[model samples]
Target: MRAIELKNVSKIYKNGVKALAGVSLTVKQGEFIAVMGQSGSGKSTLLQIAGLLDDCTSGQIIINGNGVSRLNKNVLADIRMKSLGFVFQSFHLDTHLKAYENIMVPMLINAEYKNKSAMKERAIQLAETVGLTNRIEHYPGELSGGEQQRVAIARALANNPDFILADEPTGNLDSKNEIIIFEELKRLSISGKGVLVVSHNDAVKDYADRVLTMKDGILEHTDEK
Candidate 1:
């Protein structure tokens, strides 16, 4: 049971703004957890800390049963690269690169693939997984919002990470695309990936195994739907 846990985590910025206060959570592989909140309620901050993109001001962060709150930057980077995947609302794809090429970007830094051919194969497989096989050669600028977002999701899985942290993944899309993105994320969780999504949309609650609410830096469990 691989899991990421935050034990009594707290974050205080240099300007004395407390973004999180004693927030604790545990997300395990094959589980889908959704966190919903209003803007400025610390949801994004919580995702950043859990994803290892930002440091918490106090408390512990445990990944796969090891406390990693104090690990050095390089080691943290290595762990983040190998163990975690991330998706963002903006669909951070390279405008100049084709869909499959953008998906291959993360594999470039990973030492698991020995050559470009293997990376390309993996990228193609991921493109197929996300239903982008037909658009593999299209650039980001040429794809629809939903298609671009699917490419971003495939790129996130390029490294075959165990956990995914997504922040407002469907913020820029229509209702149809929102459901599409949520369904894709839900499918990923069923495939043994721990998924933690920070979203403002209530529709996510329907797909998540657990739903939590954030209010003024505090986390509260919501009744199961």
Candidate 2:
């Protein structure tokens, strides 16, 4: 029953350009929702707002039934850290860290792990979940595009969050890797994680429970597949 809900959300930049207009959505646990659109169509903006990485200019955001529109930055930060996981198109792994080390980054500040040993164990488990056990000690520079993305996915799962918000998660990969990433995401949703993916690829439709299209700052249509 846990869900992130956006009620009539709108975002307008300081330059007077509107990125979203009266958009409303709900992403619940065990659901895979894909938002597809052309570039500049506000899909990324929608994901950022939903993930609490950016605030909407107007309207309400509710996470797990608690309204978060008025919460302070620190509280919002805590909620984001504990409740949501994020994966980006650009694998944001630290260049200086090994694959397992990168996965452990999020657990460093989390209250769940009391010591480094526990964090490392969880990181190893996550690496295994993403099929990166053999590459856990490798650096990002040493991995292929698919491998780096797998590392990013492992890092996102490090905190054991309820929801995963991914923005163009397979943008840098070829077709094979794209399918791999999508399958991983679909598997995560089946494992009881709410997944919202913003992607340009139509292949995502094959794996999504629902597909929403964005056009010119509006949610143009929704197709339940």
Candidate 3:
């Protein structure tokens, strides 16, 4: 099954910046795809489109078999909350919530599980998946950057979304932590979740099953490992 399909997608910002120009791509289920580009190369824009955080100026985005281009804002938000997982360069966990609570936020809002107990159990499972079982009670400020990102990753996975859209997820980490995070991402893909990440680090090329290089608002056909 295809996790995402973008056909001739284009995005032009209000300030008249053309971030993406007629880009087309397909991500199959369980594939690990990486988009490599410098700043302003449209990698982040592509991710936003795939995650339903932003709409394209033209063309279609089919995510998990649903056409997302024409969905109303409310429906789009629902799709975003339920169908996609996002990891960002900065750990966007709530400062006030403990790691477990942060991971549970999405589940609570989406009512992902039938009961409160089930939700809590799933949150704990995700925290353990991200290697944060012991740190689940720690607040974001109390955790290191890597730990915070792990919490964010667990939060993203709380919904068991079929697709993961990550934007420079390891950008804020040290080399050691970057490796750890990338390994977790790899595991996610290996476990049958499609993963698409926007990255500028050459190290990502080593981890990606396919690498797309973007330049001047267009994606270049690139080599893959």
Candidate 4:
């Protein structure tokens, strides 16, 4: 089964703003897909809908062969915890928490890890994966922007979710850091994890297997490389 599938999805706000217009997509394992668009083009809305952070007005959303468009809050939370990971433009790390603690948040809440030491070990591995082994105990305030964003990415990987959704993940970084951030995302894709990234920078598309453009909440054009 595809990691995630959106079938004719549409989103209409309560104020009558149609953010998505019959958008459909299928993301398979190990595919690095980049979505590019200008501001107000519904890219974030699309990610919100795809990530189940917001509801869709109409359509089917299947993840791992199970439909989740209308699942209850508890069920949705369960699925989110088990099947999805997200990286946002603003690194959402808790300022008071250490990098290792931030990365351990997801696994701590996951029902699969009964032993706390295992969770901590996994968090350390994630920190190592993101090149933060030397700074695992640093707080977000002590870290650079790139380091903070790396922490967010590490937290996103804690669950080992089938897919990772990144919306403007490198928006705060310089050119060098932008490439660093995207290289980590590319590595995840190379390691058999499905990745969907929404970016405004053209350079980001270079790391993707497929590039798609969104306009007025609709996918207008696609290029596969």
Give all TM-scores, in the order shown. 0.98, 0.98, 0.96, 0.97
Candidate 4 lDDT over residue span 1-225, tens digit each? 858899999999999999899999888889999999899888998898888899999988898898996689999988888778999989999999999999999988888888998898999999999999999999999999999999999999999888899999999989998999999999998998899999998888789998999889899655844
- Model 2 residue 208 lDDT? 96
- The predicted structure with the larger lDDT, 2 or 3, is 2
Which digits, one per residue and each the tens of the lDDT, describe model 2 over residues 77-161? Answer: 9999889999999998899999999999999988777899989988999999999889999999999999999999989888888
Model 3, backbone clash pairs (residues 3+ apart or across chains), number: 0
Q: Give stretches of model 1 more than 4 Å off.
A: none
RMSD per model, one decimal: 0.9, 0.9, 1.2, 1.1
Which segments of model 4 are wrong by more than 4 Å?
Answer: none
Q: Single out the weakest 10-residue window by summed lDDT for candidate 4.
A: 216-225
User: Model-by-model lDDT, in order?
Assistant: 0.93, 0.93, 0.88, 0.90
> How close to the true structure is residue 53 of candidate 2, measured as C-alpha lDDT?
93
**What is the model-wide C-alpha lDDT for candidate 3?**
0.88
Cα shift from native, residue 30, model 1 (Å): 0.4
Tens-digit per-residue lDDT, 10-105, candidate 3: 999999999999998888778899999888889999998878888799989998788987779999988888878999999888999999999988
